[model samples]
Target: MMRHLLPLLALLAAPAFAKPDADTRAWLARTAELSSDAMEGRDAGSPGHARAIDLVERWFKDARLQPAGEDGSFRQTVPLHEVAVTSAEMRVVAPDGSAVPLKFLHDITPRPATDLPATLGGAMRFAGYCSAKEIGAEAGPALQGKIAVCFGSRRTGRANGAERLAAVTAAGAIALLTIDDVGFLVEPPRWPDAYARSVAHDGVTLPSGLPQFRVNGAALATLIAGSGRLAAAILTDAGLHRDLESFDLPGRFEAKLTTSQRKFTSQQLIGLLPGTDPAKAGEYLLLGAHIDGYGFGEPVNGDALYNGTLDDAAYVALISQLAARRKGKGFARPLLFAAWTAEEKGLLGARWWLQHPTVPKDQLAGVINLDQLRPLFPLKALTLHGLGQNTLADTAKAVAEGLKIGIRPDLEPERNLIRRVDSWPFMEAGIPAVNFIFAFNPRSQEERLYRDWYVRRYHRPQDDMTTPMDLDAAQDFNRFFYLLVETAAHAPETPRLSPKPGT
Candidate 1:
């Protein structure tokens, strides 16, 4: 009898095939439509993004969601200013009076400064990781009038990006050159960027730091040729966070930089799904996903369009599908569906919405952000960003367990991925919020797929719809998210922030 029941139980479990169900099919169809080349990668403030907005507004209307944006409209305009580098040229002036021209995007990609100079030149000085401790007391005199080259990798015990900047700036460096770390297999460096650009909220002041650049790993050899240090050894040591000595390279770093500036406006789509119970209707839960991608840039394998199929377009479609499924029904608390813009430029869209909320900020009970989720493999587990930091974790775990999916806190905290997504703004505002990443076992094929996606497709034109996807995995995650939202929205008590230390 027990053996017979075991077989029956297996039949009742969710299928593990690669085919998608009707619901997943619809969600994927929407994703394909939004991430197609016709959408021009949906860059924020671009015509492509405008079309995306129109499509989403229609979806919201069809789903019976109420207009909950500015002045009762389903759209909230966000003003933004953009700066793009039009031309860049760098050359190495070797001590022996030889000049070698470095390819712009191939050899190095410079971060365009707000107050960019037409030309920059300085002697080359390497300061290992450029950490405060490594720079030492004489850093000021050592790096002055030189271009400080540092290892670019954020590690557990090393000084972070901001600290490195302060240290180098205080040392009077004319500019900074950071060799991109190659050992971070999770997200390796991919050279030949589409373009260098920056976007900021309109009327906001942009930082005027020293002009900085990322040197391609292959180009490191050229930068350190006469320093008597092997580029491979330097990168190997840097990857392990080992201490390295500082030295001046036998070259003068020179560059010519040119940029174009423009100002434009983007809009965030906001809609409200009303609740059935009047008592809990006053409280709200927000579900958000960014709908922007890198519009166009330098071509890769002859494709210049950066179709962000999974980066976020797929998740945006997921939220739309959720709204459509709950079209005629209601949870206890109202649900806010947000299609954020300019997420690629920073968390500008979400940040702006937080600053100018459509509903009372205090009424927002919790948030579930959908981004950085990759269903390349079976959805056996999930990595929750704010797992132990909020009360939402319990609800999320309960829902996930019902679907047989394991829930765990971030396993890669060194990446600081938790604070990099849109939910962070809500978390900062004392609201319970959570974001997710599909988990994979160490040394498993699933891990390979996950890491490969980050290396080959992430933030690249190769992230188009042609990439293979595990439809079953996608469907499982979809179901899990839908149930999670339903559980949170119907809970008798609203989710609250966990108590902070000393509180």
Candidate 2:
């Protein structure tokens, strides 16, 4: 009789476990809606982006979230200026005074300054990998008043492109040129079309008036041949060692760029769910995701739309789901949900918020940013950006443990991912923040899937509604996220940045 009753109980519970919860279903539907073709990839300042914003606003209203933006509105405007190259001509002048014409988008890609002059010319100087220390010491004077040429990719600890450009221009360099070396598993590099469309904040001026160009290896080799320095030898040395020697090359390169400019504005959507506890409600927990992606661009596989389903739309959907889940029953701390814009345009929206926050910056407890959450594998582990930087990591660890999910460190820390997402601006503003990514073991099927998705779908039209997803993994992670927020909200104290030892 006991065995018969056990079988009957198992049969009775089957239906409860058969279907996904209402929240998970709603999340998936919202993701599909956002990634639909009608959204036009949700590019900033575009009609499709406007529709996307309206959709999010509707979701917020339906969830009964309070407007937390400027003037009790849900929109925060971000002014932006866009510059695109209309025409370009470049030549490498040999030591013998012969000129070799370089082709655009093939041999080299020109990145004109936002406010460029009608015509420009300079003698090219090879500054090797222009590290900050090198620029401050030897390369600074050497790069003065010339077109500074340097390696595009650098090893860890070196100044990135923006930093290198700032240092070079401050050193009085007239222009900048970067040569691309072949990277691991990314051969015959495909230059990004974004160089043709440069966007920047309208009020923020660049460090210099230098026009920059990223030349292909073959083109750089052509220029290096005249300098009596073999390109292969330089590349081999740079590849073998972390640091390389800087020197003055033997050529004068000239480039002229014609550009067209336009000014436009995009908006960041913000909403608030007030906490049940008024004392803790004063300090808010920020949750955010970028709602923009590359608009229509060069078509791949007969598709021009970059739907960005997993690139960001999925996470934005998660935001809506969370808002709806806690609508009537609020947490202990208020929740601030922000759908950021112009993230692909250099994190402008987040930076703008840092400059103009809805509430006082100190009133913020911490931030959890979501972007490009592709749930293609099981939820065994998660990679938390800025993991050990603050007390939030402790909360996250506890929550993940309760859910039986492992918390892992960023595997590709060399990518500088912490500074690459929406959380960076908050971190720079002295706010505690963290970003999440699904984790996979080294060289496993999960790793292979992640690599394949990045190579094929990331920033491409292939990341559309049709892309396969692991729904169970997504639901599990969503559950963990919901619980994590509740745990943080009810904690005795707001999350704070952890001080380094001996500080």
List the candidates' TM-scores in order: 0.95, 0.84
Clashing pairs in 2: none
In candidate 1, list every pair of residues with a backbone clash.
Answer: 194-298
Q: Which ranges in model 1 have alpha carbons more than 4 Å from their true place? A: 1-19, 501-503
Q: What TM-score, to 2 decimals, does candidate 2 have?
A: 0.84
Given candidate 2, what's the lDDT at residue 458?
Answer: 84
Model 2 per-residue lDDT tens digits across residues 425-491: 9888878888888889887999888878877788888887555566678889999888888898889
User: On a 0 to 100 scale, what is the lDDT of residue 96 in model 2?
Assistant: 84
Best by lDDT: 1
